[model samples]
Target: MACLVRSLCDSQPVARFQRRCGLFPAGGAAGEQYVVKNYFYYYLFTISAAMGQEVFYITFLPFTYWNINPYVARRLIIMWSIVMYIGQVSKDLLKWPRPCSPPVVKLEKRTTAEYGMPSTHAMAATAISFTFVAVTVNQYKYPLELGLMGAFLFSTLVGLSRIYTGMHTLLDVIVGSLISALLTALVYPTWDLIDHLMLNSPLCPAFCIVVPLLLCYNYPKLNHYSPTRADTTTILGAGAGATIGFWINNRYISDALAEAATHHVLSVSGEMLLTMLAKFLVGIGVLVITRQIIKNLALKSLCSWYKVSINDHKALQQFRIEVPYKFITYSSIGLNSTVLVPLLHKLLGLN
Candidate 1:
């Protein structure tokens, strides 16, 4: 208990440096000096963190599952993958220490061990919020004010939450937000072009899957203290899976849906709502099962082939074992999202 208190209360080197540089107030316990000590701020930031989590984003999966808009679904998948890839690559390359580390701000979440120059949370929030606004307002003809205001408020709160939690500095938040904005602007315009080039071509899906895998395989090595490779692998795998799934859907499922439009799966609003709920439940269940099975199989096969015990952490550290496992698992998820779920809905006469 004493040690835990010391860890929480002691001034980190980064905090001290920030104090010297006038970024923070000098001369008190880290918590005492920071505005985050207030209960309101703490709770607010905590909620913001939760909002930026991957699981929170999964709520948007129903949009795709219900076939609300295929274009929107595709954009969501691609945007998520791109933001994660860029944010993680930047984190690894910059190798900046998190404010929570010793000689930085007091650690809020001890399990957080990654570098934190530009916070991925901030970047993701910005990317998702911005993309949502752009899609809804410009493409879907939603009210610009409503879309912009909501996205701006959400993204701003998420960015501020990072600072309040001592997870990122002001500069980190700014950079993260800017990176998202820039990427969204560039990528949004190119979506139509990419669809034109890749959607109809037989060879394009193969290229998409191979290229991302190759990139992950040859990803740059970290020069400083290394974080787990699991995050990167997951992103790559999901991207690959989405790529393949998009192709399959574009070629097969989409055409079938168009032709089946006259079939009239649901005749009333209540039935449509019920069908959407059922699809969400069933689709998510399949996705979870697929992810777990692939992860276990990959781990077991790799362990056996490499002559290493599954429990041997030190031995596993020497191998880039997570790459294949994450790729397969997330790809299964992506493929399931775009192809399997839709097919099931059709076969069940729900859509």
Candidate 2:
């Protein structure tokens, strides 16, 4: 893949086109443009991740590259279930032939004991490509034409690599790419709604930084998961409840107490510190009660209405830092929330 792309970057025709377009100004330096371009496409991961963890793809080119967010792994997991698992099961049921064998190549042992029908890596890469599309097209001003061309070409190459590695057939890779693209189309609408809605508020930090993170860290599904619409709603509710409780406690409750203490319309004592304590407790009580009701409703919505799986204790579990750095890796697993969380934070100001 790198070879073809790198070769494309070095092509004389492409160089001529760039020169004609004035995109490769002589002042920009020669010879290194293609190398830099290839670096951006194939090796931009050097500093993207947190400190301490790095990796490199030893392709025809053999240098370490930084790891993409762990959440990409999560996204692949979900994508695989949709594309690989379901597709593989369908083939088993229908008895599809293997490409390597007259029937199929001998199935390889997977680390997690999962079967392959469609290609997981292919689906995941395709999903990431779609998300990059949503980010450039829907979230940012990056040109859609270039973004899509890159995404499609990149996804295709990644898919093909799986076939060359004997992990999947060409048919499996194609189906996986289709599955990812389809899932991206299905989810991004709801995903975009969350992104464009709450980015600028004081709670933007909570939605973007806190919620997606907290959800992903909580893991049994919640851990390492990014914030969802349900999480955003709860954050909004909690923020509102906190704001209101603060106003009521500070303005009314405090004044009311001062009046009782001094028998005046309003009075604040120097020594009545316990009263402030009481007010603070009341505010916390309001927050807790409201949060509980919201959590219950969220659980009910998933369990009763949507029939989605619910990890009831997800919110309370401790995040594992096992292989400690893998935590960052795991968080990048699911692009559903990944694509939504940032755009939600950028476009909406719920705080």
Candidate 3:
């Protein structure tokens, strides 16, 4: 079955197009090699690809939530979750292969094994960058053209990075970008209504938690395993946790405390810069500790219930174990980013 799948993938027209675009010599004789034309692009696109990665998301989202504005942070996460979930699920449904490697030099090897029909990197970059522009235009005073230009640059870099890294074809990048833009457009009109419900309505928290969990559990399956489902769960879980945290802050927290979450400044002096740097360090430290503790606890507890060794990586990847543990760990991280971090700021006199 695997051989048949591989044969079809190699023979597919889309795959052939990608191979031709790569410009690498296919079926070369022994000792023949492909050389990079420019080291500058190799480094630049590598950095751009990092923007769509876990490390970037983990750092960027919390900075936005803790320092920039919680309202903006929540909207970015919501948009990201929608764009990424659809992209990931679509990859499984379509079951497209990455560009064939003999003709395509895969610079980033980690994700080469995953399906790459619609590039999630492109989707995420488009959604987050454009959504940031759309959601914050009214609240903050910035030139609209500058904001739009920034979004375009961001999306273009990420899209180009996917092709340069040989993880996705041009078709993948284009379609992924268009899909995210469409989703953002459809979702933008409801931002105010969603924001209102998330802050004030009692049903918001429950909806946030239940809907994501259900989606994770019912995630599409494949004969071959992929990280898409687990990654999607992590995203949805964090978004859910963040939403609940915002709701709690709006409901139970005092007026003064809630005000802290809403306030922002356009400029930062040297002193303020020092303070934000401190907050970023401290808040990230607290979040890391919180995540590790919860993750270990969740893993051990789940393993115990399932009668599997916590050290067994395979067992941990099972749907029952993977979904709950990742969901629990990231949700806690998300919750703390919105709720506890702000409280910490007050106690430490950083705010």
| Model 2: worst 10 consecutive residues (lDDT sum) | 57-66
Per-residue lDDT of candidate 2, residues 274-332 (tens digit): 54444333333433453355455544454454344456445322223211112222222
Count clashes in each candidate, considering only residues at least 3 apart in sequence or on different chains.
6, 42, 0
Per-residue alpha-carbon lDDT of model 3 for 1-351, expressed as tens digits?
987545434424433433444434334442134454555666778899999998888889889877777778878988998999999999988988887665566666567557987899999999999989876777787888999999999999988887766678777888899999999999999987888888899898889889999999999888866888889999999889888988888899754444333333377699988988999999899889998999999999999999999999889989999999999999999889888988998899987
Each candidate: what lDDT?
A: 0.67, 0.36, 0.83
The order by descending TM-score is: 3, 1, 2
Q: Better model by TM-score, 1 or 2?
A: 1
Best by TM-score: 3
TM-score of each: 0.80, 0.33, 0.88
Candidate 1 Cα errors over 4 Å, as ranges: 1-43, 65-67, 100-111, 138-141, 223-225, 254-271, 317-319
Off by over 4 Å in 3: 1-37, 256-265
- For model 1, give the 10-residue run with minimal summed lDDT: 257-266
Q: What is the C-alpha RMSD, rounded to one decimal, of candidate 1? A: 7.3
What lDDT is reached at residue 49 by model 3? 94
Evaluated against the true structure, the overall lDDT of model 1 is: 0.67
